[model samples]
Target: MARAHRREALLAAVLTGALTALALWRVQPGGSGYPVPETPEVCLRQFREAILQGDPERIRNLLSEEMHPHQDRLVREQQPRLTQTLSWVIVQTRQSGQSALVLVHEMHRDGWIYPVEYELLYREPAWQISRISYLPPEKASIAPGTHVREAPWGQELSAPPEPSRTEGPDPEDTP
Candidate 1:
């Protein structure tokens, strides 16, 4: 019984140490928990942080070279809202070649969620954001009363209708 107790205590100690180490690693800056933004998803997270922190320099650093001219405009558009933003959740990411689209939903403190998509291009050093577009909220299912299928709008062609009292109807009596 004493040997079993010692083994249990050793296992618990090892688990507790591992958990603490993982927590610390994630909290440390520049660590694997928050390493440099190499992919589109990570880059977008940095972009979100910069916008919420109101750091224009960081924002400019993350933009593509073509967007350099619009730095001032972009900086002016995003204001510091660290308190207003609860978190930015990444919904999906689509990547093809050097371009990527990251969909993110920004949860606000006011119970509103706004979706935004970021277009990023892979540059030499890292991924750079090229465009930002807002997306409409997705519906769970299509609304009722909406047409599910479509047909041609123009007049349809078919055989002409037969007369109700045709002169040829007398042929029936002959038959």
Candidate 2:
């Protein structure tokens, strides 16, 4: 009877150990989390590395099919330009739920800096890129006293003259 009881206790302990290990494994980052990054920082780091390395294949896999073509074109078109004229650096990442927006700074060869924003969408159990947009740098407008004359093929030449202020709002504004 004692021997049988000992055997039963050993079996129970083995079962409990197995169950605990299984639970722990399921709760691990990638095991349960879809497209887990190990950590959020890792995700952003990987993104920057992918860009600097010019690995479009890795980038493409991270985007939806609809978004893939656009990024592919961007890499194909911009990479040469990027290699020649700019260096990309990730400035920051803003993440909400599974989506993230990565802000990148492009340091131009001429010492100009431009900010570009990348919209990342996480879906289908993975993180995929959705859209990318360029944000132009701010510049001061011409001074009020500065002479600004329109030349041929300029804004004034291409567009018809606007009605005088006395004429009131345009037709499009009426709606």
Candidate 3:
């Protein structure tokens, strides 16, 4: 009876260990026990910081050079407009395998929200943004909406506003 009880206890311990291991595996992020901490949030935070600092070099470091030519073209063509009216506000991110898709909403000075999509790839153990594609907020079903509008500083600037009398606390007034 003593030997039988000991065997039963050992079997129970083994089964418990196996179950715990399986649970951990299933809940783990990267399919293995080790999870990469480079999540979409981290990526967006880094991207935002780079942009606000106006550090194109840092932004380039976060992107694959394979994408540089296309990005450069975009920068040259759109810089004049984008610099004025567009800022990135990341909305959501989804990850699968070594790729992530980031959904961003553009905040315009006029309070318009435009949806854009970015495709990011992880290669050589580092996450690099590969492509940026604009999408219709209504999903791919409808026609693409305008991605940007003309702002005062953009290429399509309208007549400048009349100079404000508020400027310089009235030149005629004494200090």
- What are the RMSD figures for all models against the true structure? 17.2, 15.9, 18.0
Model 2 has an lDDT value of: 0.62
Best by TM-score: 1
- Cα lDDT of all candidates, in order? 0.72, 0.62, 0.62
Ranking by TM-score: 1, 3, 2
Superior candidate under lDDT, 1 versus 3: 1
Q: What is model 3's C-alpha RMSD?
A: 18.0
1-175 in candidate 1: lDDT tens per residue?
9999999999999999999987665321212244446789888878767776776667777888798898777766655333555666889999999999988876656556668888999886578899988777543232323364433336666779986884565775785
For residue 21, model 1's alpha carbon misses the true position, in angstroms, by: 22
**What are the per-residue Cα lDDT tens digits for candidate 3 across 21-59?**
876652222233333326655655565555655656656
| Inter-residue clash pairs, candidate 3 | none
Which of the numbered candidates is closest to the native, going by highest lDDT? 1
Q: In model 3, what lDDT does residue 159 have?
A: 79
Tell me the tens digit of each residue's lDDT in model 2 across 18-57.
9997666522223432234443445545545566688666
Worst 10 contiguous positions by lDDT, candidate 3: 26-35
